[model samples]
Target chain A: MNNQLLPERTVYLVSDGTGITVETFSNAVLSQFDQVRFKEIHLPFICSIEKAKEAVIKINNTANETGYPPIIFSTLVNIDIMNLLKTANCIFIDLFGTFINHIEQAIGHKSNNSIGRSHMVSDSEKYRNRIDAINFSLSHDDGQFVNQLNKADVILIGVSRCGKTPTSLYLAMQYAIKAANFPLTPDDFERNTLPATIVPFKSKLFGLSILPERLSEVRNERRPNSKYATLEQCRYEVSESEKMMRREGISWLSTTTKSIEEISTTVLQEIGLSRTLA
Target chain B: MNNQLLPERTVYLVSDGTGITVETFSNAVLSQFDQVRFKEIHLPFICSIEKAKEAVIKINNTANETGYPPIIFSTLVNIDIMNLLKTANCIFIDLFGTFINHIEQAIGHKSNNSIGRSHMVSDSEKYRNRIDAINFSLSHDDGQFVNQLNKADVILIGVSRCGKTPTSLYLAMQYAIKAANFPLTPDDFERNTLPATIVPFKSKLFGLSILPERLSEVRNERRPNSKYATLEQCRYEVSESEKMMRREGISWLSTTTKSIEEISTTVLQEIGLSRTLA
Candidate 1:
């Protein structure tokens, strides 16, 4: 047996909501400790004292079985439930308690102590804006809603499979930005001019380009052995699209090495769109 | 002037990649202190020592201007760059350093120490899976791809405007789960049975219902004064859909008060789907 195999520990993600915040936060912290194996137990929606007691029993059982104190990462807002959970035979990391106290002290006011408001669609205006943005983006994807170009906060133009759809959707979902994407086809390349449909909204247009090799590889996954996926075709499309963007004085970014998050951030920053949901 | 108003603090989110990890982490932490205002500065793609120096200068300037040291929350992986950032006039919260050290000691191995791998699409299989899931979810949204029901990991059925599309997209994007959503129409309510297309995938079906008043309010915003936007119609559809779900032995939840994150998590857990991406 390899002695280097680190001992395993139990980690519980306890929350009153879906456990997303606690899970993501714990994962970010645990990711730093790559050597220790973790058995994650998610105790979600533990809002009541009874549920908290059940969780404590489960945590104690795990500690007994493992001969090590389990680590509990909790985002519970109810003080009673949090106090009950502290009774478990584990190293309780109250992820929210200390921070909430600090914040309350700094603000000189008590929080509403509401449960599960972090992701709630509580505000009618924000909810409506998000829903509207989602519907608009879906309808306008891949050059489908050219007639509605004026509705977009930003329009993304690029060759096929250049991270346009995902970035647009991210911007819409995360920030309620009305983003539309249009594909530049071979015909557009031959014309060597901005599409007539998008010229009216030139200022809102952004271009995404990718390395020809990467574009070809991405396209080949969906349409194998086709002209659309050919490296030569990819090269031509990228070259022409960059030229068109330059001539039109539209800013562009390459998506070759960037993730969807990176691409969306850059697009929002470049277009000066505020993140409404954040 | 309101004496209770807390002074604002300057907070920096620094990372080598998309800055998503640090941004999300800091936001989650800062959200607890809602009374204390914050001015967020995002320094993304800080991969080199030169860029780190520039960030240091900016941080120091903020400290001087604010008369309080800025709070630097960083996820830097490079030791040299991390060390250089320490020179900044700020309260440095080394988000990754101590954890890396703990992990190194436990694992008896060093991390790859590579920059910007958190959001990298370096693994072709994972990237392809994510892209495929996105395409599949989009095509199957809103009862569009009934013929492809068998391909879905989970199928969310609900009345119109029950937060189905955004939840499906979130599942696909965050977990690489092929989620399909179908809307139950008035005709389906009259028929009083599961749709023919989804009958074969009964085990994979999940139901989303919403409060009738809230549903009507949501629909009224889109199509005012229509029968579809009537509270009576919403009540009928929600009642019928819940009955159908019960008869079919499919589990269900209400999206009236839950966030998209909560809805997605419940669906995945109820359907026994493992999260493929973090």
Candidate 2:
């Protein structure tokens, strides 16, 4: 009841681009503070002085209402707009402003100081590569297009609902890595060998396993009351898949409590593939 | 040739967890220096003193070989390990070390001082929500599942290869929004109306568009020499789709030169949906 009486503090994510970078960075930092009940307000594309002034008004209003100043994490590139935002009644943490001049001194050059440089289509080749990677992951999802397995940077093998698809797509979308995923069905377990097509790319194979209880829960969402969703069946598949992975000497991780980002990072590290943003 | 002769400068992304946030922050900051060509090296999972020592060796080696110090962007939470890293022979930019103190002061409390708190599965409910959103987006891609359009936060409609699939997936993956995408076909263009299944949820509709020349180029990569990949057909489909979207009073944007982040941001802003991280 006392917690409920506390007013929610405001945290503004201000950026001249999509605010994606600032949001990610802020989440990483703010997640460490568990006591503050933060209400995030995104002020994206604040490219002009007018927009900055408007954001200032919003920030000041929130501070007035909450009786506590808002915390603003801004990544503005324009000097004039940033100066305007700095005047707002808040704890202004300028992300770019804090680091840009230091980087300039170290690199011995001036920054481009352009708006939307981080998440824009400045390099057409890299943009096309990312699109192609996404298309590849889509077609190759769930062993759909096994014919192009040779082009994949990593082949993820796992039982159904073990988080193969999301991990593959994340690797492709964020890192521009062509990741193909294949499910280990009952037949593969019976045969007691890796999938024939994926055997050729053994060096790039990564396996995902999950806790049987959790796997059954995830499967029940797709097909309730079916044998596939039974706890016994999930246990069987997970054990067999682990055995197969061990026999094939493929690096594997349990995805029972891991996020997609964690799984993708582990997969890239195990496969010795350094992440390259598209 | 002179540009090629310049030695590739190293930029180390050091973090205690998956390093996703640090990589993103580094990219956003380093992208401003268009003149410096950086070679990124990931030193993820650096939670131990041993790992931090190894990173110092690598940074020093790189500095010795290149005759210039590398730029190290780190987000380590361990004060002891971070202090050790500060002794390395490089331009150290401590991401967390720089701002965590200020945030602690402003919030009037001590941080939890935990490792891997951001990208880890710390919140099980939010993690499940993200996984569920990904599954929903995958099932609804290219108009596969229309029965649950009412449950979606946003529905993206556009001509084939006009950047609907990637945009939809990015929204789900990054923002944990239930985003469904439907491809506008020639038949829809001939009929001159939105799809019947999507008409009921007109308020949730958002559209994406692309240049005909770019659309043709993207399509040709998939199905070469087909009528669908021709410039004329792409132009017809794009123009008709735009007209239909305008007539139906749906907000839309051109994705021809936009990144997935940019397109997703615009869609969320236009749909009046505040991005909620699951």
Candidate 3:
């Protein structure tokens, strides 16, 4: 068997959230190597100190079985939990280590505590920017906020029904960005004016627009019988969104249609927020 | 200001499906260079022939605007579509080149003739294994074939409330593993034996066991009032599941206190999938 060719190993992924992103990262990175066979285990939703210890015990047991060693991938693992993991017979790869050091160096801020996940909240004030970005999307419809849009971490203005929600969520989850999206509406057509609020943020403003037919199909799924779902209506909306963006000199994207991941990464790349979300 | 310092570039991430993965790659890689100011225009749903032309138009416009010339970070962009963007004033970074070359050389496969967003589904049988791996995650909850346990890319055998579903889905999506899960019901625990069909696939098997308290909490979330969520019941089930795994010589992971990402990544790293998915 190939088992004789490769050594057996174990890997543990620890995280602040569900370890979803960390898992994805670990899989992507480790899959590059095929010479080793690993035994993987998921430990989700361990939100306290006692739970971390429980994990440590299980990991210790796993190491004993592997007869070799293990690799632990942890994201935002509390120091106490990390220490507990240290007791296990293996190597630990902490993703948060560099980030924490970056944060401390970037802000010259000393962490208030060293034991728990509480340090993440020390800069709670920055979270409002993300909330505001969400609120900005909710309040600003289409090119209305085009001019002030420069304030956005990443301004994603798209045609109605373009895959915006998923892209936004992906960016937020992956890179911790304040991604704000505003959809181009019918009114955006007649006036074709970039919103005053968006004027200041114009530099940061980016757009997402899709094809008429694609937009219609997506809309039709939600409201099948309405004129809004009709091809003619879709054509008009697409035209208007395009015209409005052009009039305001706002260059936007056409998701008409791209996969959510594609659009998200593209958007993150275009705007400076690529660094934030990635 | 710095727009001139690092000319805003356009990186195309063309894909079928959701484009979530490749897009993240583009963003992550690019974001590392803080000095690079790029204007990303993501084209999703490039699977369509029509969307191909539209993508070209956007590429043209962005290249003209970003005067220093744009850089297209394209993933899964149709080569035909590339024809349109090729003439645009930019440097294109093609993602499919290496992958396609690798496949052609290794698998002797004829690439699929379909349009824009289609992944490299080769016409040759040699590449079928890779395609199977890629599409593995799409079919989950195929509960009809418990007897076909051997067919699974990965089989998760664990007690209930041990983070199985999410873990299964993660494996499928990340590794394209057709993961089928069978919960070790209390009856099995009481009997201390695995399902009869799982005996042959013991090598491909993985077990998840959660600590009694954690299992109780997880179960409580679904069914708040029950002996099933009780610490005593959890202890009994975990003990029985462990005993069965030990008797069968199947390796198991403890889900009692780890995150799902950690679990899935551990598996991906252990079994080895692909670099990008990790």
Candidate 4:
């Protein structure tokens, strides 16, 4: 076993574009070494040498403060900026360099190596699709545009504060899916059926339920001391909504403990929508 | 050099929750090796041994069909299920096991190893914060809720279809940032200043502009041949909006060629908002 387990260390996520790719990558690798705590600093849009030098200074300062060499995870495409960053007092992990070289060797051609190419809106068709999805999601939110229900790829239904909107937006932004979400209010629970507007789209409906106490807590934060925020009302609503889902043969999952990402993924999986990179 | 370059490979992303962490991690790693094409399959909520067996069968069949060991990137926390998956004929990359062990040792306690813990909305404070951010973004979208402009952590200004909505949603969903976006219409450009409602919050404003031709192309797809979709109108809007931003001393960026992630990162950086993982 490696004996280099430190109590804490500084980590820098450097990127020419969003720094999201490097951040995600570093988190994954660092998650494996749980012995060390990381104080992460994100440096995005380091496309110029001046910015790169500034990043080096920041990284070195972090190293000096921490009394240990920082770990710098970078996805820089520009050779000059990459070289400048290399002069920092840290262990540099080049996320793109080796892979680009390998790709060049295998394809027998040079890469564009343009800064910020990975996250560019270079493909017009994909960009249009994403924008269309976003527009559709926004218009269809909270059952606002019921007439356009037919255009939806997935319709998420649940009681208020059950995490419908964020999940819908995530589905739209991440996968370009036209996800519409509707709230299952007390009126729907009293009727004991899905909303009339979404009835025609039962095949596309997915449900999200939450623990009654948790639901009450979430609702209370929004509207305290109201019938809508009462634990009894929350329990009744959750049970009735879930029952309605079962009777309608719509699949449902609990949002009591799941993140928006998890809820969105389950919704997509239930709707049989394949994840696509846009 | 080893002669193991394949034209295509099957990549399975297996997880106990959303599979998002594994998917993001795998994509970042695979982006390095750009030569090989990946046919990615996402298998989420694999929490049971039965599901693990099913995943193994699917993985083995993929391997047999491809005549190469399929690469399976998993974030399963269940030891028994992990062992079961190991029976499959594929290259398994364990994302959690080693880290959990190291963390357990360093912390001097055993990890709960509960499935889907990373993305769970278990903490009420954080969950409320995220929901609040999402609500703020949605309510303030397209300059609708300008009266509440002061509540925004960042206010993004751009012409229509300049990728503000998606970026705002991303920032809210990912980092719990209360981002509001206002569209820079021809009216705002005509005045040659920031909107009156947002003038007091000038420090929170950022701008997004796009190439006029690209803006025209994007708009034409929505409302073809109309004044709003005409190339001349788009050019005028783009140029005027940029000039207004510059004259007001608001930092502006071109969204014509940038992705939402890139745009959001730049916005956050310019506003000095530290990226916080929720």
- Residue A68 local lDDT, model 2: 88
| DockQ of all candidate complexes | 0.37, 0.82, 0.06, 0.34
Sort the predicted structures by DockQ, highest score first: 2, 1, 4, 3
Model 2, span B88-195: residue lDDT tens: 899999987699899889888778888878999987888888888888999999999888999999999999888889888898899889999988898887787788
* Top-TM-score candidate index: 2
User: How far out, in Å, is residue B86 in model 2?
Assistant: 1.8
| iRMS of each prediction | 3.6, 1.0, 11.1, 4.8
**lDDT sort, best first:** 2, 1, 4, 3
Put down candidate 4 lDDT per residue, B77-189, tens digits, no spaces: 78898899899997777766634554444335455567766577656688778889999999999988877888899999899988888888889988899999999888887
Q: Give the chain B TM-score for each candidate.
A: 0.95, 0.95, 0.56, 0.90
What does candidate 3's lDDT look like per residue over A1-278, in tens digits? Answer: 56567755667776645455455545434433445555566654555778888878887787687664467766544577667777777666665453444433432344332322211222333433433343354334343444445545766665666655545544543445656666656665666665545556676667777787767866886689899899998888777777777777776778753544456656755664444322
What is candidate 1's lDDT per residue for B136-193, written digit by digit as tens? Answer: 8999999887777888999988888898999999898877899999888888878887
Alpha-carbon RMSD of each model: 3.4, 1.6, 15.2, 4.9
Q: TM-score ranking from best to worst?
A: 2, 1, 4, 3
Clashing residue pairs for model 2: none
Candidate with best lDDT: 2
TM-score of model 2 relative to the true fold? 0.97
The TM-scores, one per candidate, come to 0.89, 0.97, 0.40, 0.87
- Lowest summed lDDT window (length 10), candidate 3 chain A: A113-122
Clashing pairs in 1: none
